[model samples]
Target: MGGLATAMLGCPGMPELPEVETIRRSLLSRLEGRRLVAVAASGSPLRQPIQEAAWQACVGARLEDLTRRGKYLIGHLGRHAAVFHLGMSGRLLVQPASSPAPAHTHLTLGFSDGLELRLVDPRRFGVAVVMPAEEVSLYPPLARLGVDPLEGDVEAALASLAGTRAPIRNALLDQSVVAGLGNIYANEALARAGIRPTTPAGRLSPARRARLARATRDTLADALAAGGTTLADGGFVDGDGNGGYFAVALRVYGREGQPCQECGAAIRRAVMAGRSAFYCPRCQR
Candidate 1:
């Protein structure tokens, strides 16, 4: 493999907006309009406990729509909606009802068409919950999410960070600041914006903030088009179990010590807020 490909290889990370949006789109066609015939749980708890009764309420309800907010997938089912979050190592797979499920499968929703949607999370950090369809927007998790870079005015959102003293990269990861941006895209966006990840959020000028905002949108758009980033550990995949191709196109997320594709300077890595931030030393600054 080439250097770029080699640099993309790294351990799994959480699914950000792009990965979650990709999963939502991949599952929409197969799941929407299909009646949920059954619901099952593995009795293992995730980030939140799997309430079989709440999920059971979704049974027999036709899936009217599947939408995304931040990193959550919402399935509209009559009076109820099933919400899903693919935590650090979670996956949502669509397979035949008769197909054997992978281990750590927390929740399973059987459709009327012999297909089944499964939530498999090895680390148990994902969530599967059901509540009134009307209440989805009011749900704490969804309600607290800030501006969605793709769906909302990201420039305005970034502007709100003008006074934040946290590192620009960390501020971007704040869901209340820019919903759904994780470390991977945060680092990539900083590189694209010609800003260092360690730069203080409050220190960014208006022009730089605008540049970073645009870079964030562009980075996410590219990742969504590529399906989503699937790390070397194969952490993220679409509902069809296919890995995304964006990892190879990553500019800085996991390329520590690698040559900067733009400046030939070695990429640098910094530990910030317990997560790794990658940046081009010469290009970003």
Candidate 2:
């Protein structure tokens, strides 16, 4: 693979905490208090099918709340709910009413203010499900997600990590184990903690694990602060329509073939559990 392709492949595709957090913040800014005049869905076969009549029945509602549960974005439109999962390449775009809908735009919500919200998913892995707002928790996808990494107890994250014999990187990617982490942040967090990616989750000393936990939280917070990373594919954006932090402050994620900023060691790349992990062997472990 070429340099850029290799770098891009190392990260996970889904919306991590930072990306989802940015989306939540953006929706809060642009979508809150907006009346949903209409709702529509396209793309021949959705990853999760939405029945047409059932979808329309939920339209014409007002947005009551916007929330992030793990990697999912839930929009509460009074009496009904609009749930979105930015699986891999899905983008929630806000556009002026006169603009032509983008090619991959699968869903659109026309607002009363002459603006439109579009859900564009080139890969079609993302899904949109509409249901009664009061019972959104009963939906299978939202129900299956674990605790939000940013909001959940730190001790709980440590306890969960302690139970897994899998490598710490894999443990973080498992949604049932800890929600909202993808490969990019996992590598960044491990690098920040100076922990080897292959280290067993259960084998770390309490102090080291604590450092890892803190690094995880801090890395995510920083990413959110800078907005989510923006790739060449135009996947993520911040609240004010800017590039993500990953592109700005990434240390080890896409820096392979370059010297480690901290210890001058060459950044190494390896596949673990079918995902590429970038780390500095000399600096880590």
Candidate 3:
């Protein structure tokens, strides 16, 4: 209905391990004691609309734990848990409850501290599912995702990719293959490993796979240190309005037409799965 609402419908920037980690950290600090006093839905289908009364039922519930499963954030509040997927454009904002609700704010959790945790999704693709806390891990979305790169093992990741014929890049983006890597880090990792994005998954040499694994971990760690990426027109912000770490340290993603930071070669962009993949031909191959 509004620009923010339209924005929510379009895909938000792909989030990698670092960006999700940043969100998890921010929510842990800001929403732990907060209560979910109300919920509201706007411009969303009735079947999945953010139910106001359903959310209100959890009023006064304390956030017992906060965890990240792949790219999703799970908030355990006693017997109930709130699960959120940031989608492509979903954002979670913490602000004073008195602050006017933004137009695309589909879900609001009012806290006793006079603050509110808002789910502002311009595309309306983000979802907030409520379920029993104890069963959260069994939820289909959470259950299907593979190891989170931030907490997963490199050997395991390589083993998972050992026999695949899919492009190494595609394998990296497959949630069931290895959770939490999006296009950005996938490109960066391939570049760092000196592996081509078009390389066959099972074709990677052991040394190269090890390099890729190290690159994946290192790139994510660097992004975590810097915050996260902030793409053009993609205004992802922390509670304080700071840009993400990966955004600041981005080397190849969104840098098409620019020189590669490592090899001085031109960075290139290609479409894969209808999404842009940025890489440096010289460095990546």
Candidate 4:
């Protein structure tokens, strides 16, 4: 096969942490130890200005390591590293060398193995920035985020929340509290933990906090294994162009007015922190 998937897409939407993780896993399988043969930018500039020289520096460099911090992908290419952020609706697709580049493909990283990885984003929000290998953590875009929810220190995360009266739902969205959480999984985890979204973060009993942490970790892990949630809009998908099965297992997200799968109560939606939160009142509280 030439590419990562068999489909062509324009723009979908922002992929949350789990979706981003799934994409990273896909890249790792294809990119590890591969030498980058070329780099090209074909579309308009993304949310940030494209540095032509930075993109060019990737040429002839080997992908030594690949990792994810928050929602960003860090590719160690010899002396330089490139960080990728899939803004709303961005797709990082892998294809064969013979395939024609898709429309709105902002960047392509050609590898010695004949696999071409394309970044397509009609919205032009996706970007790849090249930086010094040793200074990736200090890079401006990644410096302020919280720890990875799956592998990060959960006790430290909970300790910080004990002093905040912020709504538990809204607090989970804060990257500084626990990196890479988005609206959908936040709703799902809270429901799984049987905690109300509107509950104050600091008011969480120690036991509830433990359950929330467990639920958050398990929810994200399960979603990643299931290839991340692909909503009805088809916003999030893996490199293989497949939608996720995790959506079928969702407890409360996007299920407003529908009966709760666990308690049979009517699911409800609330506006918190300017985002919609779906929950079942009886099950959550």
Using TM-score as the measure, the top candidate is 1
What is candidate 3's lDDT per residue for 105-151, written digit by digit as tens? Answer: 88777767787788887766677888877888898888998777777
User: Per-prediction count of colliding residue pairs?
Assistant: 0, 2, 14, 8
Q: 65-130, model 2: which lDDT tens digit per residue?
A: 889888888888878887888876778888887989888888888887887888888777777888
The 10-residue segment of model 2 with minimum total lDDT is 1-10
lDDT of 4: 0.82
Q: Tell me the spans in candidate 4 whose CA falls farther than 4 Å from its real position.
A: 1-12
Q: After best superposition, candidate 2 residue 211: deviation in angstroms?
A: 0.9
* Residues 113-219, model 1: lDDT tens digits: 79999999887878888998788889998999999889898888878776788999889989988888888898989999999989999889889988998999999
lDDT for residue 122 in candidate 3, whole number 0-100 = 70
Using lDDT as the measure, which candidate wins? 1
Work out the TM-score per prediction. 0.95, 0.91, 0.90, 0.92
Q: Which ranges in model 2 have alpha carbons more than 4 Å from their true place?
A: 1-8, 11-14, 232-234, 238-241
Residue 6 error, candidate 4, Å: 27
lDDT of 3: 0.75
Clashes of 1: 0
As a TM-score, model 1 comes out at 0.95
Candidate 2 yields a Cα-based lDDT of 0.79
